[model samples]
Target: MKAVQYQNFGGPEVLEVVDIPDPKMFADLVLVRIEAAALNPADLAFQSGAADPLVDSLFPVTPGWDLAGVVEQIGVATAGFQPGDEVIGFVRGQAMHYGTYAERISAEPRQLVRKPRNLSWAQAAGLPLAGLTAYQAIVHGLKVTAGDTVLVHGAAGGVGHLAVQIAIAQGARVLGTGSAASQAFIGSLGAIPVRYGDELVDEVLKIAPVGVDAVLDTAGRGSLSTTQALAAVGARVASITRSSTEYEGAIDVYARLDGDDLTRLVELAEEGKLTVHVDSAFPLGQAAEAQRVLAGGHVRGKIVLEIREEV
Candidate 1:
């Protein structure tokens, strides 16, 4: 089996494709032949040593969380899936190791759900990490409800695009912040586009003078300024990237892997209410380059590593 591994924390240049033995399928875990793996900002941060303090790395590590693949084997106790089933997962364990960027991965059944029938392998691979972030932030963290006006920072990017749809599905009126170029994409998701910049606060204010009922900051760098200004009294404002503890009256959400929670997202996609836009894809061996692209931080949607031929 071939997998992307890094010996020391650094840049994308540190990654290399190496041949390793097939994963030892363990009891209580499902073994899948990798099809597609999606890149996320966290993968870049962890690789660049920024997230090292929070993660305990064992030197050589495969990097990725989002995955869509075909199940080849399952532990004796695994009940929901059989060989040949299609699945998707947020395949993170207790620490950094044995990720989805490889040709195979053994994931805990609790972290996976059946792939949505409507999605291709690339789109399914893009769903777990990014979709879960938006789903949890909007449905749980912010508690957005009908008639509420919601503001999402970086709303045209990976998580934001799905967050807009999740909010709209729940009947909330959404306003998303992005560059002027993303206005049309944001609008297409049924959210009012508010261009982000020095004028961000003013643009949001112009749309909702009374203030927004909820704010989800998918964009991490210094987004608090805009979020705080648009939040109405008692609004639940939260961020996925930064700690809300640093900001007063804000929430911080860490995306968790729950097969059950992901089912709702799958259902939405199958029903045509949710979709993943693949910003770009690189061959499995080009994992290093894919990390570099995502690290640039201006990506429009989920970036993926394609292992199998596109479906």
Candidate 2:
């Protein structure tokens, strides 16, 4: 199988397309012929060796975390999937010891969910990591509810876009922070778009004078503090991007790909309550270029790598 691998970490140049052996299936894992995979900011951090806490523990890595594929073979103990089943999920960050930038990958059964019939491979590929992160931050971590007001930072990016829709689906009045360029796009997701800069707090106040019920920060700036200051007393505030300072009244959330969460996200997508916005697609051999675009930031949505011609 052809795969993207790097023995050393530096910049996007460190990533290279190479022909590698296929993954061997474990008893509880399924061998997937990868159709598509999505790139995340973490992939760039991992590749550049900046996310040392997450990448230092592993080396000679392949960096993709979200994948959509068809089961080429099933493990002996895997019960819910069979050969040819289309599935999407977060691949274990560690096993990508070589990453999802490959033609084939072996993932644990619990990490995957059936791909929604309504979505294309590109859309499905964009869901796992970003969708799970948003779902967990808004639905699980913050416990967003109907009639609540929620604010999402980086609202035009992959995770932020999903968060906006998920919060709206939960019946919350949503607000999202992005640049002027993405304001209209974010508005299409049912969120009141607030430009993310000096006027963030002021703009939010104008929209919800009483303060919002929850705030989800993905920008990793000190926006969490701003949100805390603007939130209603005892309101939920969380950040998927880890915080440097301990927040007194907010939860710092980093999403994990669990069975239950993946299942629920899939259900929401299949039900049309969730949307996966794919910004771009690259062929497997151009994995490095995919990472380059992701690094430039301000991406409208997720960027995916097409691993198979059919996908």
Query: Who wins the lDDT comparison?
Result: 1
lDDT of 1 by residue, 1-311 (tens): 88899999899999998988889977888999889999988888888888777879877899888899999999998888899999999989778988998999998888889999999899999999899989999998988888999998899899999999999999999999888888998898889998878888888888889899998888877887766677788888889977576468888888887777799999999989999988899999888888878878778878999995323
Q: What TM-score does each of the candidates earn? A: 0.95, 0.94
Clashing pairs in 2: 62-98, 62-99, 96-99
List lDDT for all candidates, in order: 0.88, 0.84
TM-score of candidate 1 to 2 decimals: 0.95
Candidate 2 lDDT over 1-311, as tens digits, reads 78888888788898787766788878988888888999988787767767676435356677787889899998788899999999997886543384788888888888888997888899999998898889989999989999999999889999999999999999999999988999999999889999878778888888889898888888777767686556887788888777625466667777787888888888888888887888999998888888889888879989999887433
Task: Give candidate 2's root-mean-square deviation (CA, Å).
Answer: 2.0
Q: Ten-residue segment with the worst summed lDDT in candidate 1?
A: 241-250
Off by over 4 Å in 1: 243-246, 309-311
Per-prediction CA RMSD (Å): 1.9, 2.0
**Model 2 reaches what TM-score against the true structure?**
0.94
